[model samples]
Target: MTDTALTSEATHGVALSDVAADKVRSLLEQEGRDDLRLRVAVQPGGCSGLIYQLYFDERLLEGDATRDFDGVEVVVDPMSAPYLDGASIDFEDSIQKQGFTIDNPNASGSCACGDSFH
Candidate 1:
């Protein structure tokens, strides 16, 4: 079976697209986390329904997934994994939009501000 079929803390549960992974790697490197992985979480907030939290963490939670990328690792909580299942976390740098955006298939609908989802 492919590595994607494996289920464990070594996998993010949700797949990280090439763009997303590249962006995340850049951020991690900038943050000086050669030994750190990107942690994606969903918190209560945003206009749509939920807000995405991206940070660097070296510690793993009780029920979290730890996936190793080219050289970086990705950490995701079980609770957040479902919401982020099949979601793509990307970073943009455009005149109109510049930041991390979560393209989540689980989000049935999103708010105008693009912060919350339902």
Candidate 2:
């Protein structure tokens, strides 16, 4: 049976694509971590001055906003929400690129490596 994907309306200025949600769900299941959430953040320090942060987090910090896509939950800190507004998280399982990617409309420019933006 194929699992259906349900995306929650963006409350933290971001959304996860169906493929991304599926990948997250599969990963969480593999890790056996139903208590963890996908955390997205933007921190200063990349070559372009800002970089994206993605990880599984078990702690809920103050001012953190969350949204659910299917069974996967994603968290975004208040400081990073603005930068990630309207961004979409996607997953690629191809031979060329096999990982999570962020598409941020708010980015004016990005580094050649695609790891940082300004």
Candidate 3:
């Protein structure tokens, strides 16, 4: 996977694995649109007080930091950058579980559902 930075001064806030990058690239290709980017953010109101949000976004908001894995772009907004910093994202397709997972070092605790963190 390519590790090229979008900008010299703009470093990636979070880590995106090769598997996750492939999955994201495939999904984006299926959508047939090159305008969308994979956005990762942390928001309030989960069982553990915070939850992760991952989706494709067409707009680039202010203070958005981006990193390119191959051709796929991963974005993190300013507010969510600190919360997601040093976090690694991966995709699993095993029979046991099928989805993207986040490994965050900053989380002190997480809920039972494994969907939120404190």
Q: Judge candidate 3 at residue 17 and give its lDDT.
A: 91
Instruction: Estimate TM-scores for all models.
Output: 0.78, 0.89, 0.90
- For candidate 2, what is the total of clashing residue pairs? 0
Choose the strongest candidate by lDDT.
3
Residue by residue across 2-110, what tens digits does model 3's lDDT show? Answer: 2233332365669899999999989988999889999999999789999999999987765678888888889888789899999999999998999999999999999
User: What lDDT does each candidate get?
Assistant: 0.75, 0.87, 0.88
Model 1, 26-96: lDDT tens digits are 87777866767688899888876688888877766566777665665778887887788788766777999
Candidate 3, residue 70: Cα displacement in angstroms equals 0.8
Q: Over 4 Å off in model 2, which ranges?
A: 1-10
With a 3 Å backbone cut-off (N, CA, C), the pairs that clash in candidate 2 are none
lDDT of 3: 0.88
User: lDDT ranking from best to worst?
Assistant: 3, 2, 1
Residue pairs with clashing backbones, model 1:
9-66, 10-66, 48-116, 48-117, 49-116, 49-117, 50-117
Give the winner by lDDT: 1 or 2.
2
Q: How many pairs of residues in model 1 come into backbone collision?
A: 7
